[model samples]
Target: MSCLKQTVNVNKAELMKNYIKKIFAMLGILLFKVQGQIEDRTLPTFATYPKRLKINLPRNIANPQHIYIGDNVKFGPGCFLLALTEYPTSKMRNSEFNKATQKFNPVIKIGDNVTATAYVQISALERITIEDDVMFASNVFVGDHQHGYQSAATPYKYQPIWKINPITIKKGCWIGQNVIVMPGVTIGECSIIGANSLVNKDIPPKCIAVGSPATVIKKWDDQSQIWIKS
Candidate 1:
C-alpha cells in the first residue's frame, strides 16, 4: 500500500511540473505578442506615405511636415533626415540678428523607389531633392548647408550659412558607402559615385565618379556601347 502511495505521489508531482512549464510557456508567448504590438505602434504613419513604403525601426525624422517621401521607399536603421523649417540660430554667432532676418523653410523631397541603407544622414536647410530610383549605401551624408567663417579670426562653427543652391540627386543614381554630398552640388542621372567619395561639385550624367572631391573616372559612350575612360 505504501509503495502504491509513493508511486501516486510521484505521478502527481510530474504532472504539476508539466503544468507549471505549460504556464511559463504561455506567459512567454503572451510577452512576445505584446512586444510585437509595441513595435508596430512605434512606426510613424506620415500624412503623405506612399504605397508599399517599408521603413525599419530607429529612424530619426525631424520636421516631418517639411519632409516628403514618395512611393516604394525603404529606409534602413539609423537614418536621420532633418528638414529645418527655421535656421538653427543657436549654432550661429549672430543668433538674434540671423533668426530675425533669415527665412529658412527647407524642404526634403525624396522621389519614388528610393532605398537608403543604415546611417544615412540628410540635412536640408534650404532644399534637398532626390529624384526617382536613387540608392544610397551606408553612412551617406547629403547636406545642403555647411558651417561658414566670414573672417579669419572667427571660428567655423560660429558662422553657419545655408547655401542658396540646393542639393539635387538626379534619377537612377547610386551613391556608394560613406559618401558625402555637400551643399550646392547636383549628382546627375544614372551616375555611380564610388565608395568613400566626397562630392563637392556637379557630376554629369551616365558617368562613374570616384575619390574625395569625386572626379569622373569613366563615362558611358553611347556610340561605342561601352564605358570610356575620362
Candidate 2:
C-alpha cells in the first residue's frame, strides 16, 4: 500500500496578528523601563526615601526636602507634592518681620505603605500628614491652606493665603477620586471618603462619608461587625 502526502496550508492573517501582538508587548516593556529610569532621577530630592518609594514621571514636586516620604510609598503619574515655604498670610504679612522666624517652614509627612494612584496633589503651607496604609485615588487634593479671596477684584493667586491650618489623615483611610480635603480637616482612622466629596470637616473613625460636603453616611459597628446608618 502506497501512502500519499497531503499539503498543509498556513494562515497568513493569523501569523501577522501574533507578530503584531509581540511587537506591541515588547514596546510596552521598553516604555515602562524608560519611565522607571526617569522616575528614579527625581528620588534624590526627597528628605528621606529608604529605597521602597516609587513615583511616576511628570511630578510637580517643589521643596522636596521638606516632603518626607516613607518606605513602600508609591505615587502614580502627575503626583504634585509642594511643601510651600512662603504663603503670605496675616502672620507672614511682613517679609522683614517674618524673616527672623522660620523663613522656610513647611512639612508634608507621608507614612509607610501609602499609595496614591494618579494626579494626587498634596500642598502644605504648614503641615499635611498622611498616616500609614492610607490609599489615595486620582485627583485627590489635600491642602493645609487656601488662597485668600479677600478681594474679588484681585486674582486669587495675587491675594494672601488664609486659614493656614494643618491637615491630617489617619491610618487605613481611603481617599476617593476628586476628593478635595481642605484646611484643618482630620479624617479619622479606617474611614472611607467617597468620590467627588469635599471634606471640609473632620470625619470620625470607621465611617463612610460622601457628598459635595462630605457627611457620614455609615458607621462601622464593631459589636455587630457591620456598617450601620449614621
Candidate 3:
C-alpha cells in the first residue's frame, strides 16, 4: 500500500510538470508572434507578392508617387517617401524660392533589394536614385534640395527660392544609422557611410565615410577583400 501511494504521487507530479512545460512553450510562441516573427505572422504573406515593390509598413505615408520601385524593395515601419509635388502645403512655398531645376518635381528610383529602417526620409526636388542592394539604417534622411538662404526673409506663404540638386546612392551601399545625405551628393557603389555622418560631397566607390562633412576614412581593396585605412 505504501509503495502504491508513492508511485501515484510521482505520477501526478510528472503530469503536472509536463503541463507546466506545455504552457510555457505556448507562451513563448505567442510572444514571438507579437514581436513580428515573419514566419509566424502576416509578414510572410505580404512579402510573397511578386509585384510588391517599395513596401511601407505601418506609420509610413507617401503623398506623391515619385517612387519608381523595382523588385525586392523593403521599407521598414515609419519610413516616409515624398516628392516635391507632395511637399507639405506649408513647406512647398518655401521650396520653390530656391528652385534648382525646371522639373516640377524630382524623381526617386529605388532599384532591387533595397532595405530601409524606420524614420528614413527620402525627398527630392531633383532626382534621387538608390541602386540595387542598398541598405539604409534608422533615421536616415536623403534630400536633393534645400531652401535657398537668400530667401530667408520671404513670407512663409510665398514660394521660397530652392536650390535643387540630385543624390545618387549606388549599388551595394550601406548607409549607417542617422546619416544625412545632402543635395547633389553621390554615394558611389559598394561604399559605406558611418553613423551620424553628414554627406555633402561625392563619396568614391568601395570606401567608408564618416564625419560631419563626410570624409573617406577607409578604402576597400578588391584583392585583399578588406577595408584599409586610407
Candidate that scores best on TM-score: 2
Candidates, ranked, TM-score: 2, 1, 3
Q: What value does the lDDT take at residue 50 in candidate 1?
A: 72
Residue-by-residue lDDT tens digits, candidate 3, 55-138: 444544343455577677777778777666633344353444553333356577888889987789897767899999999999
- Work out the TM-score per prediction: 0.76, 0.85, 0.71
C-alpha-based local distance difference test score of model 2: 0.87
lDDT of 2 by residue, 68-140 (tens): 8988899999999988786553444664334222234889999999999999999998999999999999999
Q: What is the lDDT of residue 30 in candidate 3?
A: 94
Backbone collision tally, model 3: 9
Task: For model 3, name the residue pairs that clash.
Answer: 96-160, 97-160, 97-161, 97-162, 98-160, 98-161, 98-162, 98-163, 99-162
- Order the candidates by lDDT, highest first — what do you get? 2, 1, 3
lDDT of each: 0.85, 0.87, 0.77
Model 1 off-target regions past 4 Å? 1-40, 43-47, 89-102, 151-155
